[model samples]
Target: MLCENCGKNEAAIHLTQIQNNEMTTRHLCEVCAEGMGLSSGSSASAPLADFIAQMGKGMLAETVSQPGTCPACGLSLADFKKTGRLGCPRCWSVFDASLRGLLRKLHGGTQHSGKVYLPPHPSESDRTARIVSLRRSLTRAVESEDFERAAGLRDQIRRLEAGQEA
Candidate 1:
């Protein structure tokens, strides 16, 4: 297939954009795709993972200046964009907004739809880990002033505690 934009080279990129119940498809060569901003820089020819990370960077660039730092590691949003890695466990909450946007852009959806691997019989350790994780999330929610999320986490924690007692 020929490039839809330039009509010169063979199409190497197929992009499907859906907006408001309308779908638009474009087939473009590397050159045209890069020219149209559908691709990244000179490294646009890189693998899909790199391309997706580039897209995430572009999406996060605008929000990097937001004031928030990981309470545990002191990682700022700008630092995450540069390294593409969180400095500490608490960084997730600190950079939640930017990370969600980046995740949605990179994965096309933020929700996890993949199969979860669980042991046939969950051990006591698993329950303990779950409770610990929930407590951390609850703490982060409260610190971030997300009362609604904190409430939900509280309810979940209560349920888990009740289950343990029972």
Candidate 2:
């Protein structure tokens, strides 16, 4: 599908935003999405901020200000929309509802799916350190969407478990 914003590049990012019982949808290309700071490298808060902004464009604009603002930092949904950055960590709690939906959309599931690695080393400390290293590798694999490497990591973890049982 063509990008809603540019109408030139193919839309790769499909966003459905809901706020105050209102829903708004936008399909954007990588470039357009990046322009709005909605690209992959952007911070976790960007999509939620953008989604809130899109939803606010309709009837909820005025009503959202008071309740939507972070009590600690005084960062409103409007401020998030403008900056694409949350005022502080407290903003996460303040806007938890909105961010949850955005997160579900971005990731297939809200729960962490990345595998944890354990090693079969004799020394407990060595095993712990190896597990930490392997977990870091697994995290990078999942983040990069490298299914092959992730599968390998899973298999390695399984082998470690089998060795432990023996």
Candidate 3:
């Protein structure tokens, strides 16, 4: 088929999207696919369908079943597809040839270039700790009938809640 987007080259890439029980498909050549960020080295992250398209476009049909099953859990490609899961951790290594190649194509290269995840920031926790300490002091002031200190602590907590540095 001729490329749908550019109508210039032969289509080598095909994409399909299903939304709200409706299906839409696009056929594109290498140039158009890359322009749509559906190709390797694209800065924009492709969605799950793009990942599947990268896998199933032509490779799935041409791939010969690698000989033998996973040594650790005995999972074949067919079993993995049918079950939609790997048999065990070792399945990754056992299926390394196929999996790694697919990953390389879907991502730009073998190394992960995307952002590494980080936990909540330390300053946020520190703010929470400060708030807790102030609340405790406020409670102690109230217990001792120290209205002036209690009011000051209450105002500090209100400022903290308002996102002001107290």
Candidate 4:
């Protein structure tokens, strides 16, 4: 495909933009796409550089400066930053606001409304056996005083329970 803008260079990028309820699709080569302020790399063009700078500024503005606190254990975002671990499930709820900003930075935005396909239907007995194994692992972790491992097992058990319920 040829670039829509250059009409000479072979297109290597497809960009779609929605404006005023109308969708516009453009096919462009890397150079043309960069010229239109779409590439992530630094551009020599003043307009493209300015647009990228503004986007960076906007992202910086949206970042969470204040630390979040876990409601259950009173653990703070600073705690997670230091240890890279969460206290409990309740930490998710408490840290959600701040985590959303971090997630957006890492993943582009807080939109995970995507599809996930599962097996047609696993046997109930199979799920039950898995839950039992997870419970045993959790018990062992607790007995060994490995709280982190126990927490992971607990979360797995909870997910299994939820899947079974569904």
Candidate 5:
């Protein structure tokens, strides 16, 4: 498409503005748009951005002013923010508003109500630690020549490692 401004260059951007009950559309190439001072249109409203940032900060501060207690687990929102995790399901309900705001900011104004996937069994870190501890016990049994204890420890370690792969 030819640029509305130049007519010679291909249109690479579309700028839309509404004023006085009339909508105006500007089709322009990047160079023409930049020359017309329309490339950084939003940055022209820096004061508005600053005002919004201040308002958001104030809202977050107000939300955190009073200690929030989860109705289900009695966990505090302030504590959860500090720890980066909620104590229980009730904490989610108690801090629903604040969490919604946070989620919107993080995910582009959309609430996250999606499915969560969990590991089938213990995580690799847990499996590795358990296996290490079991191996130590197995070594002790071997040193004492207790075949039965060694066999049991070996079986436990196998189960833990197998769970990790699942």
Candidate 6:
């Protein structure tokens, strides 16, 4: 998948974060990941396993920065590891850094490599893609001082938004 952050390079880093029963996921290319303070010594050609290991180390550092307690339920990392269960839903995040390794070992990988759902049209996401494309083109046009082209793109964006609202 493409990096959602820059929409340029292929995503080299993928993260899935769960907190308060909500899951947030994002994919990032190396460039963007480094910018976000997720710097790694791995190169683009580094093995996936290596990247994951590095990411796990990073996560471990973050969680252990303050304390071992879950902010919500006060479940300590040691306790969670001992019990092999979480005290509450919030424990997932509280122990996220520590669990990446266990999950990698248990599942053989942190990411799923399987079939996925794909809509026949994917209209909404498709529209969003179009808007992003148009916006990029609009930026280029404006940068090049092509007033006519920029105006056309601006109009197209407005029409797309109108359709979306309706």
* Error of model 3, residue 148, in angstroms: 2.5
* Clash counts for the predictions, in order: 0, 0, 0, 0, 0, 0
Q: Residue 95: error of model 4 in Å?
A: 1.8
Q: Candidate 1: minimum summed lDDT over ten consecutive residues — where?
A: 40-49
Which lDDT tens digits does candidate 4 get at residues 91-116?
87776765666567656889986679
Clashes by residue pair, model 4: none
Pairs in steric clash, model 2: none
Candidate 1 regions exceeding 4 Å error are: 1-53, 61-65, 115-166
lDDT of candidates 1 onward, in order: 0.76, 0.71, 0.77, 0.72, 0.71, 0.73
Off by over 4 Å in 5: 1-59, 62-67, 112-166
Residue ranges of candidate 2 with Cα displaced over 4 Å: 1-66, 120-166
Better of 2 and 3 by TM-score: 3
> Candidate 3 residues 50-144, lDDT tens each?
54544644445545666468887888776654443567998887776666666777786877889988968988878888999999999999999
Sequence-dependent TM-score of model 4: 0.29
- The per-prediction CA RMSD against the true structure, in angstroms, equals 21.2, 16.0, 14.3, 19.9, 18.2, 19.5
TM-scores vs. true structure, each candidate: 0.35, 0.33, 0.49, 0.29, 0.29, 0.30
Off by over 4 Å in 3: 1-58, 61-65, 105-109, 118-125, 158-166
Ranking by TM-score: 3, 1, 2, 6, 5, 4
After superposition, candidate 6 runs with Cα above 4 Å error: 1-66, 114-166
C-alpha displacement of 63 in model 5, angstroms? Answer: 1.3
Model 5 Cα lDDT, one tens digit per residue, 1-166:
9989889889887988999999999889877988987764443445544544443453456474445587677777655554445677766667777766665765667555777998756666677877898899999999999999899888888877777432
Query: Could you tell which candidate, 4 or 5, scores higher by lDDT?
Result: 4
Which candidate should be chosen as best, given TM-score against the real structure? 3
Candidate 6 Cα deviation (angstroms), residue 97: 1.3
Query: Global CA lDDT of candidate 1, please?
Result: 0.76
Better of 1 and 2 by TM-score: 1
